[model samples]
Target chain A: MLTIKNLHASIGGKEILKGIDLSIPAGQVHAIMGPNGSGKSTLSYILSDRAGYDVTEGSVTFKGRDLLSLNTEERAAAGVFLAMQYPVEIPGVSNMVFLKTALNAIRASRGQSPLDAMQTLKLLRGKASAIGLSEDMLKRAVNVGFSGGEKKRNEILQMAVLEPSLCILDETDSGLDIDALKIVADGVNALRSPERSMLVITHYQRLLDYIKPDAVHVLAYGKIRRSGGAELAHELEEKGYTDFVNEAA
Target chain B: MTLAAFITRSRREQEDWKYTDLEALLASTNKTFNLDTGFRRYDEDGDNRAYLLFLNGVWQSARSRFGSVPSCILMGDLESGYQLTLGEQTCLVAQPIEMVFETDSNAPAEIALKLSIDIGKNGRLTLLENHLPSNTITTIETDITLQSRAKFVHGKILASGTHLALHEVRVASGGYYNNFSLLRGGHPARNEINVTLEGEEAQAALNGIMLLRGSDHADTTTRITHQAPNCASRQVYKTVLDGKARGVFQGKITVAPHAQKSDGYQMSRALLLSDQAEMDARPELEIYADDVKCSHGSAIGALDEDAMFYLRARGLNETQARALLIESFVAETLDNVQVEAWRDIFRREIGEWAQ
Candidate 1:
């Protein structure tokens, strides 16, 4: 469902990702584990077409289309979703309004009719309750005064509502407690299916306990240093990325 | 001497008139417009509330559905304007009261209207002032005396096509005054309000929103004086400027020595959508009381780029994302309006402008 061929990206004249090569077929979940500044998040941002990231070389293709050619909103409408590490707080736009607008925009791009307010609210309530978000929280401003766990869960709610084919989770486990981690993992686990693909980016192996990845790749020095089975995550958690960083250097 | 002549001879370079060119504005004011008694345009009061309708500086009609006559002309100025009074000693069960002034002229004239209101002890009143004009200049002054425990709310809406507008307000002893304004700028406009807390335990709040586009210019100036003990005041102003529009906010709060327990806060925020749009904010606090709490802050910037990107990543187009942020920025000030009907009308106008 997604392909990257030596994707070299940079920002502000400094290169971040150097020769990143990975491909995730439909129905498979891939994990990218790396240390700080190892280009794991950079890869996710580049795939989502975030501004300020210049692609100096290579290319990214999603579902047989040139993903890099689309803008940020277009990329989102084409079924590419990136769950950010730190969700931005929009002080006055309610969470419910944000979700409805996003859902309708994506649907419109795919030739679907817009949903009425009642229909949108009904769908949102059903999906929100499953993730432990109350109706009041949905009515509040997006991520305003929300706890760290609530923000992460809101990101997952967006992912579920949009139902993107390709999901990119960037450090979703960084600020979550054990209970929050379980809830977020459970939300992700329920959305796994044969036609959808996920690229989970993290530095820790704790999240893998609930939502296991099909394959694990160790990223260092802007490149994938190792690719192995699910055990690779556990091995790295026990050994850390020190040896991998030194080897890549 | 008439007030206009006295104002013309006043020093133009004083601290209060530094940002505003008052001399030039007065020099250009020559023509005078008579009151239009033709009620064909504003015959309907829009809502079923007691209202006072004024067209081109003349009182057209006054209707009361709840309380006695809201306005009584105590006296008249020598050259122009009237000293009208409003409200009495008791709270009225009537609907919201509206004072609407409208003009549809492109002539170079100055329309001056003065109002003096005395709210009796423990009385309550809600007044909504609507300014709907077409390329006209206006100067308005209102003096208010509130007895102990009295409450007053002043809501004003400045719609499009107004050339210039100036307003001054003064509040007295043990009174609570709340003033809210929503201004849409299609031409140059100005609003200057001065409030003095003369009695102990008096409270005042000033909040306004300015929406400007094209070459529109609008200025809002407020000076609040806390003279008695235990008084509090708050001022918040928000502006959204697009195109090559310009906005100015000059707010000052002063606390006297007798007002030792006073609390004052002032905040001015502006959102500049286009690179050429401009916003100038001057916030001042002069305090003689050592035991007072006073703070002022100003913020001016474009929409947060990261926030914009986040919204776009969620599938909103650039215009849609920008409109949402701008509306929210302006709505923060509108949320403080206490009247439901006024709030609804302001919301509708904001929605139309965003579109």
Candidate 2:
């Protein structure tokens, strides 16, 4: 469902993601594990088509289309979702309104009639319970004054509602307690389907306990040094990234 | 032309009083006259109170009446005197002061009107002023004094025309004052207000909305001072400028020494609709008190591209999407208006301005 060929990206004139290549088939969850400053977040941002990231070289293709040619919203409409590490807090814009707008934007792009407020609310309520978010949270502004766990839950709720073809989870496990981590992982696991693909980016093996990945890739420096099964996550947790670091050096 | 001859021969002659060297602005337009010719004065015999009305910068003597001796002094250029005196427990409502200026000739003018009011202890006064200028210059100065426990609310709405205009207001001690200004037109307009909370427990709220179009310029400046303990002040101003218009907001909040527990908050936001449109926002807070909560923020931005795309992607055109966002921006000020009818009027005016 997604392909990357020598993906080289930089931000602010500083190259972050060096020449890298990866491919993931549909119906699979690939976890990218790396220590700090290993270009984990950079890859996710580049895939999401976020501004300020200069594609120095390489190319990314999603579902046989040139993903680099699309804007952020177009990428969003094309079923590419990125669960940001830090959700932006937009004041005065209620979460329900925001979600509805996003949903309608995607739907309209596919020539579908937009849902009304009532229909949107009904759809939101069903997903809110699935993500463990209360109705009150949906009524408030988007991510304003939300706890870390609540924000992650909100992101998952958006992902579930949008039902993107490809999902990129960028450090979703960071700052989450054990309970939040499990809920987030459960949410991701529930969304897994044969037609959907996920690229889970994390720093630890804890999140893998709930949503097991089909493949694990050790990203050191800017390139992937190793690719293994789910057990590789446990191995990295126990042995640390010392071997990868030494090999990269 | 002499000032007296100008006032007698033609009210439009005052349009030639040039403040700036905008010869094109002064000569390109016709002499503007006041549109509000027929104004019914409020009778003071029954439960209804008195209202002072001005038409085309000319104060109507016949409309000026007093239910009783007011506790306040009324002083201005068009009219000057002690209009009424409020008792310690009196409450006034539905008091409307309407002024209209219209013109048909190209000339510069300066029309100044000043009104002063003093509220007794524990008294409440509500003043509503609506200014409609065709194409002239109008300046209004309002001096207000509130005694201990006195409260006042002033609502000012300016719609259409008035080449250059200014509205100045000042508040005094232990008084709770609320001011709301809605600006929708004029080539260049200014609403300058200075408020002072001179006694303990004094409070003030200043809110404004400026919706400018064409090549208009709208400025809303507010200066609030907290001189006593336990005083609070809040100011919020929002502007939406389209075409080549310009919107400016300068808000300053000052907390004096020993004014402990003072709380001041100010926020200014502007939305530029066109590439040529401009907005300038300056929010300043000067606090000498140690125990105080003060914050000020200003933001100048164009319509949110993400929001625009979201709206447009949902079948709304670019204009419709832009109008929705601009309405939401200006509606923040109207949301704070206490009166429902007044808010409705403001909403209607804003809708017209947006279109």
Candidate 3:
């Protein structure tokens, strides 16, 4: 379970997420749709403890612990996963190595032994194939020279391997083709369970068609304007964000 | 015996005087530097060669070895006329002739030497220098002449206790020069290399890696010139600075006028371990040639936090994660080294240094 209470965030002294409150319980999927400059990405970044984002006034409690006190890596170890909109390209770092490190960090935090090389390879291979990535991609440097679809698939592969309690997919549908979208959606769907939760952040209803969310929220100017079921996504797709934009203004 | 006594005796006996300031530095240190000699001596065939030896920067000409006088090899092109062989294989011939320097000393001192090389038309040569000293300084100056199509490769390895060092090299027209320097030890050291590609179709590659710890200082500076058309040059240097050690890398590539189609690339990267450790990298490119591609980049940072966390999350402690990342950074440079045995040695040294 993740809870954000009256969260206010900004970057470079400019206010972005202005007093937003949201809560999601276990076993539910939530989709946050918003137009550009609506602070949708800012909320995800703040939760992930990314740099350059100042939490002016907010309290984020994940699994009953104060999430704001933890660093980025600590947040990840506490089962907070953020699929960044633009995944960083780290040259000379292999994807397998990167994933193994992340997974082991999380596992160690839970008092589990780190997987050995063979165990890591076996574990990564299965998840990679499930997410439609070839073994060659794992050997290459992380996100270096990767295509848009391949980068998204890599993110999903990471999510699958890490198996976080709460996954935040920030703009997971951006620049992905329909096939890549289905693969990403399937990755999310496979991880769905009674003990896990997901916040699927997107601007279009197309992604909602694949991974149906239990709840949908329209974010405008740093606050959730409306909350409804899957029907809200369909209505927004048909009506566009013009009404929400005017209302928020 | 102290270094002061050793230098005084050598100066009085040998009489090969040049730099008194270096001698004064040696006298001030007054430390008895000991080295295990009696390693297998390198073989030399009957050829014109210059053999030099320095103990704590004092030339030990008495113990040095030289071959028969070098003979000029006549070829079709004057610019490329000489061939220097390390056996039957053409070693590397941008400059003709070979010079070798060795030291066996017991004092913390510095050594500096110079050599001039001339290559004829279509000639090629290779110079291989190996330094295994005990607490000494080594400096070398080399001037090279290359005729058309002359090629040279200078391979050097500093395997042990050389406190400080510098190597300056100059290249002439229609020549290709490649230099590879590997540093393994010493408290504070430097390898300075300068190359001028004075001819068309001249190419150069300067690649090096320095792994240091324990208050060590390793500095590598290279200045490459593109003097003629179609000249190309590349430099890649990587350093691992741990403990309270420091590593410095300064590389500059210059393309002169009428050197059209000249291409140059320079990259320097460093990985810092402790807060006390330091790494400085400066890569510069200056071009006067209108038609050329020149770029330089320098990066200095601690190990990637994400990568480190990723490693830790997998099961490794913070120490293991840092070690793996440092090894990866230093091993990248060894990937280009040709010999597997040498690479193995480098890896072994790096592994020990990382720990």
Candidate 4:
């Protein structure tokens, strides 16, 4: 349900993503694997409407609507979610209040009635317990003093609460341990459905082992050098990106 | 001296007052020049049982629950104001007591009131003042004394007006003095607090917040002295400035030579919401004691861009995200308020200002 054609993105006159194109249908998971400086994160950030980047030439559409034109908040309202590589730590606003504000804003944009305080609390409690976030954790300032695993889980909690159609997991497995990886994977797996799609961006295949992707695109030197089925991830893992990175360069 | 004479004589070019323009403030207060027609309105203090009301510098006993004045307590009208005195070892904590003052907006005259409180040895008293923003020029000097082993908790909410509020407190041995104020800027307002710990084991905490916007100006100046051994003092002042608002904080802590083991700490932080918003902070520490711990810190900054982006990406608009960040920036300063009701009042006021 997402399309990208000849997307050339740059930050500060330095080209990061050059002539990249991809498409993902609904109910599918795609893993974008690339070594360092391969424009994997640049793609995710450009899709999520992050500032400070200029898309010199390209077109990106989500569900038949131009995604590049929408602001970050509008993109979020349009069912685009990005679980950032490093979740921001916001002191003073409780996690519960942040989630509630986000949910209500999205709902208001879609002509839905906002949930009352009690209703929001109930919904949060059920969702939090399912992903193993405690009531006390939800009461604290967002991500302040949280460990890496807890930050990822908190992101997952927001994803579940927001329930965006296009979820971009940007290096969600980088800082997580084995058990923490399982927990985050379970959370992502629980949200997988015919109507939801996830772009699991990572450097290693360890995460794809947990949340299996339907397609694997090997990105190197700002281009999608190869696109294949799930086994492509195994080949890249066995023989490191020694050839793809140099070959594409 | 006339208020005009005092304003003209004050050295606005001095190092401490360099950031604020007093001449401009004085010119803006042309309407409040009335010294003759004064105190024209009365404010309903809701339930007399909850507070002692002073409307336009006049005490309304009918609007005060202390019609049945407690034992060991004496209160009556002064020549132009009111006075309350508590006997030795008296306790005023059985009921929540708030002393509220509201100015007469119609007249907007120059009003000055003196609040003198004396807590005897082992006595306890808690007081709260929630004064609304005013149109008049007002001066309130709260002079308080705590005898040995006495305890006093004082909270204040000061807002817009050409106002000057001074809190002078003296704590004897083993006494506790806690003061917290939340202030919003007027054309020009100042809250100067001077606290002295005169005896051993005395403690004082001076914490306040200044939420200034527009061209409003507020100054928070404090001088805390530790004269006796084992005495401790803390000062935390936070300022949030928007528009061309100017906020100043000068916190000075002094430790005497004989006051060994004196502990003094001061921290000042300011958040500037616009390019024109300005903050001036100075932390002065004078230490003569060899065995003392005294430290100070100051930080002034604008809103966090990364945090703002994070909130906006989560679907909150610019206003909602800004309010959340500003609220958290000043929430820690309110923690020094020991009373929850007073804390809630400050919170409600801050929420309204954020909106």
Candidate 5:
């Protein structure tokens, strides 16, 4: 469902992502484990086409389409979802309204009729109930004064409501308690289907415990040095990234 | 010399009124066209309160609400324009009184209106005014008086025009006065508010929102005075400018020597949607009392790029994201509207402006 080939990206003329390659087929979940500054966040941002990032070289493809050429909104319409580590706190725009607007925009891009207010609320309620999000929270401004757990749950709620084809979880496990981790993981688990794919990006294996991945890749110094099964996460937690760091060298 | 001209040659031009060239504005608009309009017309199917309509400063009694209107509230037409006096035990809680004004013809002309409102002790009232877009030089002067323990809420919606609104207000002890204006740009429009807290324990709130684009111009100037002890006032104004449009805000506060324990706060924020857009803010505070507390804040900025990217990544296009963020910025001021239902009116207008 997603492919990154020889991915070399940088910001402000400083190279962060060295030449790298990774792939996740449909129906499978892949986890990228790396220490700080491994270009893990860079890869996720490049996939979503955030500004200020210069793609020095390499190409990224999503479902046979050249993802590098698509802008942020276009990539969103194409079902590229990135659960940001720090979701932007937007004042005045209610969480419910933002979700509805996003849902309708993606739907409109696909030539689907927009849902009315009632239908939109109903659909949001169905998805929100699963995450234990209250109606009041949805009515509040997007992520304004939200706790870390609440913000992550809000991201998962968006992922569930938008139902993007390829979900990129960029450090979704950071700042989450054990309970929040389980809730977010449950939200992700419920959406796992044969037609959907996920790339779980994390620094620890605890997140992988709930949303277990089909494969694990060790990323360090802007390159992926190892790829193995779920057991690789447990191994990294125990042995640390020392071996992976040496391999990159 | 005209008032606008005298201000044009002020010696203190550098300190205040530097950004807005009102003299040139009034000079730019001298020709006036006659509207040739008369009394008002309105439908009263669902609304129970009196509907007062005015065309080109003339009251239209034929089309306005009469049978349902309470006789005790209206003070009849006067040489100083219209008047409303609410005595004690009076309350318009059922619905806000609606006043509509329009021009008879589509002609650029100078229209002046005057209104005076007096609330007796402990009286409560909410007044709403709506003006249609008349591309002309229009001006209105309002005088407000609040008695002890009285509460008065004034909300206004203005359309595009060279509109100038001058408001003079006074609040007695235990009285509260709220003024909110939502302006839809202008060809150099301005609002000047003068408020005086006369007795102890008086309060006032002044808030407004301005949306401009395509070379439109707007200005909000205010002066507040605390005459007695334990008085307070607050001001919140937000403006959004796009294209080459410009917005200005000047807020001044004064605490008299005898006015101890006074509290005054002012917050002004503006959003420049494009590099060509501009916003100017000036806050002035003069304190004679040592026990008074007064502060003012102003902020002008463009839309947050990070917020923009976040919205787009969620599937909104550039236009949608920009509009949403702008709406959010102004919502801070909109939330301060005392009447909850009136908030929807502002929201609907904001949505239309966005479109």
Candidate 6:
């Protein structure tokens, strides 16, 4: 469902993702494990079309359409979702209001009528219940004063509500405890299905324990150095990215 | 002294009125228009307790609840302005009263209005003031005094035209006073607020929001005095200027020597939506009491670009994203309204202004 060829990206005149290539077909889940500054998050940002990231040489194709040509909102409406490493705390905009606006915006882009308040609330309640989010949490400002686990769960809830075709999880397990990790992993597991693709970017193998990936790639020094099965995560966990670092060097 | 003479002397003699130039307004009032135009029609939701209408600074009509004497609260008629005096120890809960000040001329004219409100001991009242003028200069002078343990809430909306408003407030022991203003700007407007905490343990809050566009200029000047021991005051003012509009906020809080344990906080924030728009803010605190706690802050900034990007990444268009953030910025002031309908009214006004 997604393809990247020779992806060379930079920010403020310094290259981050250098000659990187990856592909995830429909119904498959791929994982990218890398050390610090390996361009893992940069790849996700490039896919979502965030500003300030200059894609010098890259071709990202989503569902046979050139993804780089679309703006951030266009990419979102075209079913590309990026779960940010740190969710922005927006005061004054309630989570429910934000979700409703986002859902309606996506729906409008697809030529669908907007949902009323009641319908929107009902949909949000169902999705929130599945992820154990309370009505009070949904009524507060979006991610304002939320715990780390709650933010990740909210991201997942948004993913469920938008029902995107491709999902990019950027460091979803970074600050989570064991329990939060399992809960988040369970939420991701429940959302996995045919015709949907996921690119899980992480620095550790802890999250891969719950949300098993069909393929794993080691990204070091701004490029993918190895591609293998899920066992590669175990190997990296045992050896620590030392071998991968040396290979890149 | 005459209004024009007072303005001229203040402009020439004092630095307090530096930003307001009333020369044009005073010059245009030389031609008198017919005063036959009565009160302008207003759409009432029928949920309000009373409607006090004024046409060009004169009382036109006063409507109250059935069998309740409107004269008990509103005094005077077209010959003079009205004085609102609440009865002693009375609580009129959940009752919304509206006061309308509207003009009938499109030409630049000057009109003066005076209002005096007295809240008896332990009394409570809610007031909504609406200013609707088209191409006219209106000066409103109001004095409000709250007796011991009394409470008063004043909500105001300014839609169009030039407004020179002055408010003087006195709070007695254990009394509470709240004043909120939403300024939807087009012409030059200035609001001056002076609050005096006279008795022990009194509380006061002053809040304002200004939305400006099209070269409109709005200024807010406030001075709060803590005259008694243990008094507290809070001030939160926000301004949003777009399309070359300019906004200014000047506020000061003073704590007297005997006003020990007094607490005062003041914050003024502005959001500039256009590169050409400008905002000026000055928050000052003067304290003679060593034990008093006084804090003041002022911030002028453009919209948060990261916030804009966050909203857009959620699939909102650029305009929609900006409007949402702007609405959120003003919601901090609007959310303090205790009455649901009043809050809705302010929200609807902001929604329309955003569009």
Candidate 2: list runs displaced more than 4 Å.
B1-150, B155-174, B182-186, B196-201, B209-216, B224-232, B236-355
TM-score of every prediction relative to native? 0.89, 0.71, 0.68, 0.93, 0.93, 0.92
Q: Which is superior by lDDT, 3 or 4?
A: 4
Write down the RMSD of all candidates, one decimal each: 4.3, 8.0, 9.2, 3.5, 3.3, 3.6
lDDT of 2 by residue, B290-324 (tens): 99999999888887765564444333345545665
DockQ of predictions, in order shown: 0.65, 0.06, 0.12, 0.68, 0.85, 0.61
TM-score, chain B, each candidate = 0.84, 0.78, 0.69, 0.89, 0.89, 0.89
lDDT of each: 0.81, 0.75, 0.71, 0.84, 0.86, 0.84
Docking class of 5: high
- Which sequence of candidate numbers ranks them by TM-score, best first? 5, 4, 6, 1, 2, 3
* lDDT comparing candidate 2 with the true structure: 0.75
lDDT of 1 at A131: 91
* Deviation from native of the Cα of residue B77 in model 5, angstroms: 5.5
- TM-score, candidate 2, first chain: 0.98
User: By TM-score, is 4 or 6 better?
Assistant: 4
**lDDT assessment of candidate 3:** 0.71
- Weakest 10 consecutive residues of candidate 5 chain A by summed lDDT: A240-249
Best by lDDT: 5
Q: Across residues B1-355, which tens digit of lDDT does each residue of candidate 3 receive? A: 2334434644784422221223543334433334554233232434333444444444444545533423332112212222222322233333322233455534435544444556556656656566654555554544566555666666676654534444444455556677777776444455667777777777788888787776566668788888888888888888877787777787878888888999898989887777898777777788887999888888878887766544443334566567667767765666765545446545665655555
Positional deviation of residue A118's Cα in model 3 after best superposition, in angstroms:
3.0
**Interface root-mean-square deviation for each candidate?**
0.9, 5.3, 4.4, 1.1, 0.6, 1.0
Q: List, residue by residue over A210-231, the lDDT tens digit for candidate 6.
A: 9999999999989999999999
Please report the TM-score between candidate 6 and the true structure.
0.92
lDDT, model 6, position A142: 91
Docking level of model 4: medium
Tell me the spans in candidate 3 whose CA falls farther than 4 Å from its real position.
A246-249, B1-85, B90-162, B168-177, B182-188, B196-202, B209-218, B225-231, B238-355
Query: lDDT value for candidate 6?
Result: 0.84
